[model samples]
Every structure is written in structure tokens, then in C-alpha cells.
Target: MTDWAHHRFTANDLLLDRQLVDSRGMMAGRIDDLELSDPEPDPAGGGSAARAPVLTALLCGPIAYGPRLGGRLGTWWAATGRRLRGDGDGYPCRIPLSLVARVDRMQVRLTSPRELLPSYRLRAWVADKVIAPLPGSGR
Candidate 1:
């Protein structure tokens, strides 16, 4: 494994948009934001072990994603988002840190498929309402 210091990503580079994937290799969504935690020092010989930062969880979909992109648009987006679910849990999708299997290039591999999650409502809605209205919707 290459040392993180030698890796290509700068601090700003890490904050940009990226896609999130699942273990079955399905497209989960985009990496809207990162969840960070303080590092725990290893007690063994009082030395630091080599490891990438823990992933924690992945945030995705429009409602969850929009707020991360904060501003006027973000506020309107989040407000409209809440109305969609009608008091359903208005949470951005969260995938546990343990689910990640690998991180390569700009994509994350997970240990389970997206179907395992309950946040596919947006995907279904788009397909049913918007896309279904377009020409050759079934195709």
C-alpha cells in the first residue's frame, strides 16, 4: 500500500464529489461528505500503526446530499426533501464504516449491495414518475 502522504489527494482534493459503491458492486450514491473521528493511538510500544482513516459512513441521495451542499439551494432542497417523505425519517443515508471492503482510486467498495439499505425511494420515484413518462420508458 502506498503511504497516504505520497498519495495524490490533497486536503481540497479529498473534499470533492465522488461516487459510493456497495459490496455487490452496485452504485449506492455519491460521497456527499466524510465522517471524521479522532485517531486512537496504538498502545503497542507507543507507536502509530499504518492505516487509512476510518470511513465511518457514506452520505448519499438528494435530501441527504443537498444539505451537505449548504446555501440557499441547500435549504430549499432540504425543505422540499422533508415534504416528500411526509414525516418519514428525514435522514441522509448512512452506511456503516465496517461495510467498506476497499478504497481504490476515487470509489469505495462495500461488503453489501445497495438493496440491503432502505433508502432507494428516490431511485424508485425517479424511475416511476419522471423516467417512466419519457419516450420508450419501458426500454
Candidate 2:
């Protein structure tokens, strides 16, 4: 697994709610949660049987955001997202760790281009259906 120990920052303090940006510098979304790989045996045979968890992916979308928000409003938000997706998968969009370039004070930059991300589904739909048909909207 890739070692991120060199980076000194807590996930909750530095990552959560931070904006995600693609390689082309387009705003993708905000990070709601971090997906960590299951703990594995320490190769170095440390005192503890399990090593520290490895960062695997970043979770985005309403499905992820809802639970963090909590209460009835959170449930409704997640339900609305599920309805819009129209798919059996209720999980949030997961961006792999490999695609992440760097995490700064403000945003997490991705190695992949924006067009390749599934996170743009809602934005694309809104642009095509709601914004494109407006009177003065540039088609």
C-alpha cells in the first residue's frame, strides 16, 4: 500500500468539506467522507497485529453527504439522490486514491480529467435540462 504518513494532517480537519478539483482545474465536488482500506497485518511485525488503515477513496454525492448531515432532512436528501440515480446502487461516488494528485488547505486535486468523473451526472443534467433551455442561456 502507498504510504501517506509523510502528509501531516487529520482527515476530518483537512479533508472533509474540502472542494475537489480535476486535473483541468474544474470543480468536481466537496468531499463528504474518506473510504479506508481494511487493516492488514503489519509487514514489519510491529507489536500490534494490524497496521494503520490506508486511505482508499474519497466519497462524494448526496448519498455520502446525507448521513453526515443527519436527522430527517439528511434522510430525505439521500432518498432524493437515490431517486434521481434510478439505480439499485445507493452508494456515493467513489474517487480512487490513485487519481488523487494532492491535498492542500483548500482543495483536493485529481490526476484525472473532469469529463471522466461520474460525479458530474447531476450538474450535466441540470445544464442540459434546466439551464440550456432558458431564454438567454448560451446553448
Who wins the TM-score comparison? 2
Model 1, range 36-122, lDDT digits (tens) per residue? 543674666464456545545656656776777799999888777767766677776666666666665667666777777655677
Off by over 4 Å in 1: 1-16, 36-55, 128-139
Every candidate's CA RMSD = 6.8, 4.8
Judged by whole-model lDDT over C-alpha atoms, candidate 1 comes out at: 0.64
Q: Candidate 2: where is the Cα deviation over 4 Å?
A: 1-6, 39-52
Local accuracy of candidate 2 as per-residue lDDT tens digits, 1-139: 3234346888776789989999899999999988986566457855453556678899999999999999999999988888877787898888988888888777788888977887878988998999999988988
Steric clash count of candidate 2: 0
